[model samples]
Target: MMPRPLLLGFLAIVVLAVLWISNPAVAFAAGLVIALWQKQVDLPHISTVSRYALQGGIVLLGFGIQASQLWTLTTQFAWIVTLYIGVVIILGLLGARLLRMAATEGQLITGGTAICGGTAVVTLAPIIGAKPAQTGAVLGIIFLLNAFALLSFPTIGQALDLNQTQFGLWAALAIHDTASVVATAQIYGDEAA
Candidate 1:
């Protein structure tokens, strides 16, 4: 059974999240803070639940986007997306080699960087025979990066005087995770989101 204090702490976080927090990045940071405070509150299946929640949030965000707009944007920018992914992967691999990192770990990191962050890492982990420790490390790295992007992108976009379309495109291309990109865009405005 879960300890009473731990359970109360979790419940308080949930209540605060539901009642007050709206920003995804802030909510994530709050969770990180709570985890640090209660370092031993390990709940079984929490990872799986969090993963599904993230995926579901992304899906719900997609529903907000117009299908025609998505199709047009995808078709128009397909080449750019392909080229960016290729360059990032190649550069990541070379950087890993220069650092003399293991090939599998390097590939895992590159794949995560080039693709969808944790999702890419998790999907490739089993296929590439990555040890759990390696996967966890990569996920941690990606998660931190995503958090940074979420916090910084909007401020940078505004300081640079980027219009809604410009900021939206920049966020979509620059942020590693779809959810982060959307959240950053949302921070800018509804139009950007």
Candidate 2:
């Protein structure tokens, strides 16, 4: 293995590559591996950094929302939004039950699905007393789904020949995380929002 600092530097480069490739999920997983293998990088510090990123990410996420426009959207397509929320909730419940996950796992999964991603997961995981392994697995699953959403959602929009507005709505409703959703929306163009 390379020196710890060198390995850290290499991991940083890899992370940037993953981000550019729009596979932040892979970047996050790689980060975990590096921290585990090279304790000199400090697991706590890495975790703290990830938390800060999520916090900052969520704050940045607010920009994607348009409070004034939401009323119009709700009035125009209340049913669509309702159905989307319902499906997401149902699937989330089924996923947790089928996986035989703990209550906390269910909470974390649903919250992450319904709200933000890692931020929600991190906040609720401890509240529900989830097993570390279960929470870890849930986070991994969320990351993978987020990666798929970020990469494939644009293609899905194009393949379906969706209008920008339609694609934006779909991305916002279906994508697992705020950042991934916003990224997909942007892919459709600035007018998507």
> Each candidate's lDDT (Cα)?
0.85, 0.75
Candidate 2 differs from the real structure by a C-alpha RMSD in angstroms, to one decimal, of: 4.7
- Using TM-score, give the best candidate's number: 1
Show where candidate 1 strays beyond 4 Å: 1-21, 42-44
**CA deviation > 4 Å runs, candidate 2:** 1-67, 74-83, 98-104
Candidate 2 lDDT over residue span 86-188, tens digit each: 7877888889899997767787888788767766788888787887887888889888887788677778889999998898888877777777776667667
lDDT of 1 by residue, 41-64 (tens): 767898998889878988887898
Model 1 TM-score is 0.84
* Candidate 1: count of backbone clashes, pairs at least 3 residues apart or interchain: 0
TM-scores of all predicted structures: 0.84, 0.64
For model 2, name the residue pairs that clash.
Answer: none
Question: Superposing every Cα of model 1 onto the true structure, what RMSD results?
Answer: 2.7
| Candidate 2 local distance difference test against the native | 0.75
Worst 10 residues of 1 by lDDT: 18-27
